[model samples]
Target: MGELQVEKHVKYILAVEKRKDDFESVVMEHLRLNGAYWGLTTLDILGKLDAVDQDEVISWVMQCQHEDDIAGLQNEDGSFSGDMWGEVDTRFSYIAICSLALMRQLDKIDVGNAVKYIVSCKNVDGGFGCTPGAESHAGQIFCCVGALAITGSLHHVDKDLLGWWLCERQVKSGGLNGRPEKLPDVCYSWWVLSSLILIDRVHWIDKEKLAKFILDCQDKERGGISDRPDDAVDVFHTYFGVAGLSLLEYPGLKPIDPAYALPVSVVSKVILGK
Candidate 1:
């Protein structure tokens, strides 16, 4: 079996960020904040976070948050928009909270309102959706669960029901799908698996099989992971793949917190001031 191309993967991530005019960067401009988090967290997990300029990253992150508009983003009903377009989603809630938490600026927003908005997205099936009344999806569920975890509002989650729904995402291929009838993908390995682990129900899934599935999706030559075997690789899937392995406690990789989605040491320093 081929091993993770640790050095090559790190170089690939750094290169992607530097190529601002590239197709991937252009396409991801709208969600640059989310991309930064993924890349930075991955670097941290690989023990190479120091490769980037810390002050520069923090400054760019603050600009993305737009401190002046923080209060305005919270709707009267508590939902948040990914941008000024006003399309509310639980995913934005997670992104906002996770980003702020990493920067140690969580106090800028109303935690109570944010948590309430996410709770409003919770469905009767014990899952969460992009917005109230929307159908639940694994991606949205991870966002909701992750946001709640960051805010210490996990009480809003129906652990048993959500856990059942999440574990059900695991398919015969040992890979997980985003929803019912969807094909299995490596990305869900992070989304569904992390949510399940957070609710203390990860034991319900086949960890060994899931690990193998993620490993099989890796590009042994180029050093990035794909959504599935023999597919093209990208930074997004690469982060998720490595993160999923971290969650599974794969040897030689850093351990990641299911909720915070950062290495335990980084989460501790950010949350605990250690």
Candidate 2:
């Protein structure tokens, strides 16, 4: 496979944001805030974050959250809902923490309660679920573990056990699947790889093969990446593909913090106060 189409991928992400009437954009309207974060994070990883208006983007995020949509939406159990309706998930908890951490405002919410809620979602098998008593999933594990890491609470995680579970997500194809017996997908590269890195078990997976797997999913001529090879490319998979490459220490790409899911430069400046 050829190299990552960095310029093409950047163009694809920027174009998606402009094409408001497109299927992806329209359907993802309710998740506008999170979409902004993902897209911007992707751009940041590509070293093109300054291509957009930072002030305008910050203003837009503030406008999206009010009394209901984000703030005060945390449940009594300390988990967060994706929106005002209040459906809780560790995914939302991660998004909430990541977003707030980016804004330098993690203090606005009950961080203590959020950590407790995330810990409660941990399964005995050393994985995290979407919620308490739910089945462990790689995606949810990433979310919960990421939240805990950002809050400086890795002491709550059983690293050896969770690392074993995460490392097992890798399949024969060199790509990672979200759960056992599932076909490997490019998206899980970011989820699983990041989780493994956070828990210090990234060496458990075959990095070279994984790098090739993500590269093979790229649409060589058109840019963007798909969930798997010979499949339709989408912005979601494209972001993960590039991010996964970053995690693999791919040449010519920025390093991303596994826990924060942002560029090391940005994270150092914003979260780490460097």
The per-model lDDT (C-alpha) reads: 0.86, 0.87
**Per-residue CA lDDT of candidate 2, range 1-274, in tens?**
4588888888877877788887867888987776687788889888888888899989888886566435467888898998867788889999898888888888889999999999999999999999899999999999998999899998899999999888888887799999999999998999999988888889988999899999999888777889999999877788888899999988888999898887898789986689
Residue pairs in candidate 1 whose N, alpha carbon or C atoms collide under 3 angstroms: none
Name the best candidate (by lDDT): 2
Cα RMSD, each candidate: 2.5, 2.3
Candidate 1 clashes: the total is 0
Please give the lDDT score at residue 162 for candidate 2: 92
- Ten-residue region with minimum lDDT total, candidate 2: 64-73
Clash list (residue pairs), candidate 2: none
Give residue 110's lDDT in candidate 2 (0 to 100): 93
Clash totals for all candidate models: 0, 0
